[model samples]
Target: MPLINSDTNNVNNRGAFILFEGCDKAGKSTQAKKLFEYLKNNGHSVELWKFPDRKTTIGQIINEYLANDKDLDDKAIHLLFSVNRWECRKDMKNLLLSGTTLIVDRYAYSGVSYSVAKGLDLDWCCSSDRGLLSPDIIFFMDLTAEAAEKRGGFGEERYEKKSLQEKRIVESSLKLIENCNQLPLKEDLWKTT
Candidate 1:
């Protein structure tokens, strides 16, 4: 687990934004689904959202790129991802403002790192997603390369293979966090592990 940041205060009666972010096969989806079910069963107003929301038109293009069905310029791909997130901004804000807690499976950090891993500029990657929406609490799931490989469907995604520039992925992750630290967002962006 990475260093935890203290929980943030939810002001104005807004719902909590709980986010699960990590590398491939880190159990982010499982944890997020379980948490969503738990909250729902417990009668909390909640919703779950995932980035690269493949259901949308922009997301379809993203899916094509991720699936290797099509090729795109690194910057073009990054912008598409940013647009994917942007499309949900209004609805997400409405839900949160209406006191509906949102359990987000993945967010801008993952997209930024992926772009950086592909050799895009860090600031350029982050710029498109700037002030999108900050999570009240982020669960950063960390898994070793071997452990991640042991799980099923490990190599299904383009970035899943370790022998294929995994170092860049790790480096990009570090750069993502470092760049995030530069922005004066929430001091307590990190929470319990």
Candidate 2:
């Protein structure tokens, strides 16, 4: 059963906020969209969201960087990613409070993992996202870099390359999620289907 908050009066009581995180081609967006549709079809209020939204001003910048059209320092791009999330933070909170479930594709976890894999300080990466609303349920779609590389869109984006960095990012992501006390048990962390 989905976890529910006891405060009936709180907006969070209406629906759970779920996030999907994983490497490129691991189906985070695909699964998030499917879940969003499933919930909506069941008469639940649900919204699908993606990081580096690519629609907003900041997101556009991220899009350019990811497309290899622009070059940014590792830390610069990292902070920009966090800032992009901050731009949506208030709206996200409002949606949850309004009894809507947000099926989000990626979040702070991605920011931290990718940056940490690039040799950035883990504490700094995490601290940059402080105060962002935590997900009620987070699903990490575990896929080996080799497996992901075989996918159709692999290597299409800057971060989609199958390199040692990708492997390191996966390792960092798993460790970070494992250390998160608010997350589910380790056995429940990987969603493979």
Candidate 3:
């Protein structure tokens, strides 16, 4: 994840929605924690939310799938992930509206890209998350697939494979917000890590 910030004119008087988006082991969690602590230490209101929030009912189902305890159709698991985000949409909006900065690790981008890489339709993958709160900024963490494989416990997750992770870059997922003009999406889509 890039560890960056984003803002949109539609959301006023709200805390920034800082998002860290990337493949597994790209240091998204590491960076999100640093930003959260930095904001808290500075006396700023902040909250950290991770997707597949395994504590939720839907999340638990998704968790089982990711853990390989259960199997789901590609489309089924994709929607489950999207629903997990939807389940928290209200809370996320409330926090943002209350001026609480939300540091999110992984989100719709991950949902779409991972599924698409696994052979799901991009439009279908994006449709379910159409109205979700947009991140003020998306930090696209960049790390080579080789580098990620070298990270500890790399193969633990179901989608942590190098071949898939390489195709799982943020640029492909940026299409999720292509219609949103306020976001400063990079024109250069060919990012070589």
Q: What TM-score does prediction 3 earn?
A: 0.84
Local accuracy of candidate 2 as per-residue lDDT tens digits, 1-193? 4344443534345556698987778888889999989989999988999998899999999999999999999999999999999899878877776688889999888888888888888887787787777776779888888898888977778888777446655568888777874322222111233
lDDT of 1 by residue, 1-193 (tens): 6434243354545677898877788899999999999999999999989987999999999888888888998899888988998899889877877778999988888887777777777778778887686777778787777788899989876778765336544776555555565323333334446
lDDT string for model 3 (1-193, tens) is: 4322233233345687899987789899999999999999999999999998999999999988888899999999999998999899889877776779999998888888789888878677778887777776788787888999999989887998888887776445445445443222332211222
Query: Candidate 2: deviation at residue 6, Å?
Result: 9.9
Global CA lDDT computed for model 1:
0.77
Q: Rate the local accuracy (lDDT) of all candidates.
A: 0.77, 0.78, 0.79
Taking all chains together, each candidate's TM-score versus the true structure is 0.84, 0.86, 0.84
**Which stretches of model 3 miss by more than 4 angstroms?**
1-12, 174-193
Better of 1 and 2 by lDDT: 2
- Per TM-score, the best of the predicted structures is 2
Off by over 4 Å in 1: 1-12, 163-165, 183-193
Error of 1 at 70 (Å): 0.8
